[model samples]
Target chain A: MTNATQLPVTLGLRLLRGPAGAVLVMATIFVVATLAFFAINGREAVSLFQEMVMGAFGDSYSFSETLVKTAPILLTALAVALPARLGLISVGGEGQLYLGALFGTGAVLAAVDQPGWILMPLMLAGAMAGGALWGVIPGLLKTRLGVNETISTLLLNYVGILLVSFVVHGPWKNPNSLGWPATIEFPAGAIMPQFFDTRVHMGLVFGIVAAIILHILVTRSRWGLGLQVSRSNPRVGATAGISYERNVLIVMAVGGLLAGLAGIAEASVIQNRLQDGLASGYGMTGFLVAWLAGQHFLRIIPLSVLMGGLLASADSLQLYAQLPKASADILQALLFIIVLAVASLWGRRRDI
Target chain B: MEYFATELLTLLFAALRSATPVLAVVLGEAMTQRSGVINLGVEGQMLLGAMTGFAVASVTGDPWLGVMAACFAGIALSMVHAILVLGCGANQIASGVAVLILGGGLSAYYGTPFVGDKIDTLGNLNHTFVSDIPLLGQFLGPITPTVLITLLAIPAISIFLFRTRTGLRWRSTGESQDITRNLGHNPVHYQLAAIAFGGLMSGFAGAALAVDYTANWVEGMTAGRGLVAVGLVIVARWNPWYALPAALLFGASEALNLKLQSWGVNISPYLLATLPYMIPLSVLMLSYRGLRASGGGMPAGLSVVFQSAR
Candidate 1:
């Protein structure tokens, strides 16, 4: 099968049956089909390709936007990753993101006169606290009340969105900004300073650092082992004298905290004010990313950046290719379809 | 007392409308789940069915044809999920999510042209002969045809799931695939049939949303109603019969939100909108007792892969 003549079929089969096949096939199709379109349009395909490459990583300015895009995805991915380690599906990150951004921005606005150091940390903490509370409620419901975490968390996301929408459009609406449901800006000092002469802020640093810390926490710590045991089999972990309840709570809190911080990063660093679109679809996009990358913290960083780059390039695609803004979303969906189709073929020789 | 009566009556109709879609999908899902397969693509299937139903109905100016389109559209969507999850043996959750994404994006793309275009709605069944009859006729008269059809379907589905040979085999497969094989029934065929049933119901549900309810298509209009239906199934403990009241509870909440909003309530519409989700959350939380042991008669391999004997 590995011989020269059979290489294409073998590779195709392998691609269909492995983790990397979906992205590989999608990228191949995208490159070929898009280049074909460019050729038909009498355009220079190489220049079009170069424009995408440059838009993503042409210089420090573009690279920084990549990091900025990655920040929310990274934290939202953690929102899934942490719960997943305990066999829980925390799909509520979207809702958590909204709540975190809402309250975090609210805290900062309320403390507008305060100095940066105090207000920033306070707002960030508030965001984390809000998200953690939201996540924990579902965990508690699942553990104590026997509720399904998946539905609880999923519903919570909608609730959070509505709650945030109400507050932003009502109490938190900036009095000065005629009817736009937005929070007052944080004090200038409260904003994370730009990393260079770019809009990128320390939030990216927080994301990267959190990824490293999470890697250590999950791979090297006793808590990590306990979570692994619980995820593998809750019955066995309970028998091992490890508190499965505690594990669930811890995982939910960690997931929520990470997602909440992502909200803070967006509010204080990226958007600088809370509004209806603050969270966007970051939560849902992060779920796909986390699921695609096997939910590993370290792997999430690069994968998220890749997705972020694709999203960032959507602007360029719209301008150059006349694609709709939603085109990038379609591409992401295609990637997921291809990836899942490819990955599911592994170890299929045996029956369930 | 008068206020309470009016609220209750208003909620009754509202619950019927809201519950109609959930009931449609849950009945279909209940059948599939009984046959030892889980179709997590209910959400996507409903979305596809909804958009197709609306588009076909609006274009043809016929609600029934629109509904037929919904069923076919839903079945087409389910086939993809059935292929990936049942045929290729992919992870059900992952494949379901993929289908959901596909359904959302596909519908949005096609539905863009039809946005805000309202069609003649499916009219009420309030005939003077039936409607003039005392209280019972009055209650059933103003009801939509979709709700009447769904109410009729409940008993028919219950009979199909419990009183039939196929139903027994389906139950056996979900309970124990080994027993099913020994009994000489192919589980995959049963699963496929069950999923197709779910697709049809989802399509009907979607059609009801656009043709009967909204009279137009909107991007992501099904909202999380599909997920709510799944939750209702669990809340009903996979019983085809119990899904009625459970779906009705959710519907009533939504209807109340509409009624309140119309009456010029100063409260945020978002908060009122929260009731539908919150009620389900409360139900799931309250019903958590003794769920860990047997899962309220959930199929043993409801979401598991079944390997057939060669």
Candidate 2:
């Protein structure tokens, strides 16, 4: 009984000694600051907060919607989290996601008559391949050409989005859609299966499984240990015969695969086709989720759900509070800034 | 042949106009990078500046005042970046991305009110005395005051970088912070000053785009121009003088893209629109080997922030 009671106190003290304390403080500040903004605008702050909470988790429907949102965010967050382990800041997840959807749609369109089991896997493979190809470009550029991966990946995002726009507006426009720019909807066989009596699809299961597998692979496996070594000190890792270049390529591929999965899920399960809003800044939001989670695979699951709920509630802010949709964007950005500041402060204190 | 010549001249004028905003941003980022701090928040700063400038101009009926307001707004945001990156010793890349998001979100939120509002814009400089001259007059007649200022800024910044004593201190700080500190200079102060200047320039770029080029405000109007300017700094070998031609090259591509679209060409406008971004990527890739061999002209301490070693 003593051990059990003392365990929580010791664990809490340990968290305060590390990064968690700063994170908690920053989160508190973010909430207070947001409420202050609303108060300054002459709105009832308490009710607004209550409304947001209710909108996000008040009913089963909103909770289900939040879960639906979490699937894509989790995968995209993995895309950012994976490459971050390799010391590469790949902000091009948005581009890779678009390519994934494009390739998935193309695969489905090519084999419209195929059976469900065969077509689904093929679409997933094509999406992953497209994303991997996009992801590998930056990896290759960084390893071979000495170009900065950050800028190249970002520029490639614009290229990828433009490619999608071109195809949708030009060749892939559904002839019967009456001037709307979009591809033909996936056939019944091509669509993902949903849970009984809910909007949740197989993607949620995929995200959860991927998170668990990645957490184990990253924290418990030998390869994960090697990756940590290589990330922290490449020269030392190289001296120990670890191949730095191979890790870069492999890690980026895995990251792309995750993002690709998100893209295919959004296209086939949510929108049912590729369109202009297909990209939808999920990549950027995923990056935020990964950052908030401190790049921990296990942490990303819950953090993504929280972020997804916040985003879902942001839509209700428009209806209940009459705030603009961009209010959510502002909140997300503020949260990121505060977290960064707090983490930096924690880092500096540790140095002392 | 005559029609081609006229079209070419018009394209040149349009290119010069389009290049001014990029030049402003590239020159600002060039200076910031030269001080050993990479600020990736230029896009966000530009957006805020554009919105603030438009709002101020609409309210005050003074375009120059709007530009000044934009500059102040930029400095305010960059101050947040400076405090985070330099004061708190945060990761420059992450801090930059945060600033980018912060600037973008705030701009979008505030800009919602001014969406579709109009303001008096800066017009082109059509001096009769200048237009009286032959070929030179024709080249300069259609230029806006903002374009002329940007053109003048290239030579001015070049001289400041190469000939000024403070500029030497700034460059040395970027080369090696330890060396600069050993020489009794405060590297942090220099970096903060450089970043503030960057903010001012980015704000001016936004103002120029809003008041002179578009004469309107829109959400996310700066698009990726800020990132493009960051790339241009590398392509220009970190020299302010070289940034001129690089900016013009991008501007020219954008101008030609617009011209091609208007000419009823059969090519997809989306593909044509991609030429500006693709050109920079291809240029960076092709020049990689040369850049590596020549030591890439990057400052020695520029990437030191990424290293774990103090």
The C-alpha TM-scores of every prediction are 0.90, 0.95
Tens-digit per-residue lDDT, A1-352, candidate 1: 2678798888878776554555566578667655664566576777776776677777776777777787888888888987877767678788888777876777787788888888878888888888788888988887787677777887888888888778878888889988888777767866867776777777667777888898899999987888788777777888998788888888888788778878877877777787777757788788888888888889988988987776766666668776555556666666776666656654464233
Docking quality of model 2: it rates as medium
Kindly list the per-residue Cα lDDT of model 2 for residues A241-309, writing each as its tens digit. 877788888888888887887888888988898888785777888888888888899999998888888
* Clash count for each candidate, listed in order shown: 0, 0
TM-score of chain A of 1: 0.86
Candidate 1 stretches with Cα past 4 Å from truth are A1-63, A349-352, B1-7, B135-139, B263-266, B290-295, B303-310
Itemize residue pairs with steric clashes in candidate 2: none
Question: lDDT of each structure?
Answer: 0.78, 0.84
Please write out the lDDT profile of model 1 over residues B1-310, one tens digit for every residue.
Answer: 9767766776697678777988898888877777766666788788888889888888898888988899899998888778887777776666776777777767876677787777777888687577777755656676787888888998888887789988788788778878878888787887788888888898888888878877778888887888788777877777878889888878888988888899999989988989999998788666656455555687888643311100
Which parts of model 2 have CA positions greater than 4 angstroms off? Answer: A1-15, A239-241, B1-5, B305-310
Query: What is the TM-score of chain A, computed separately for every candidate?
Result: 0.86, 0.93
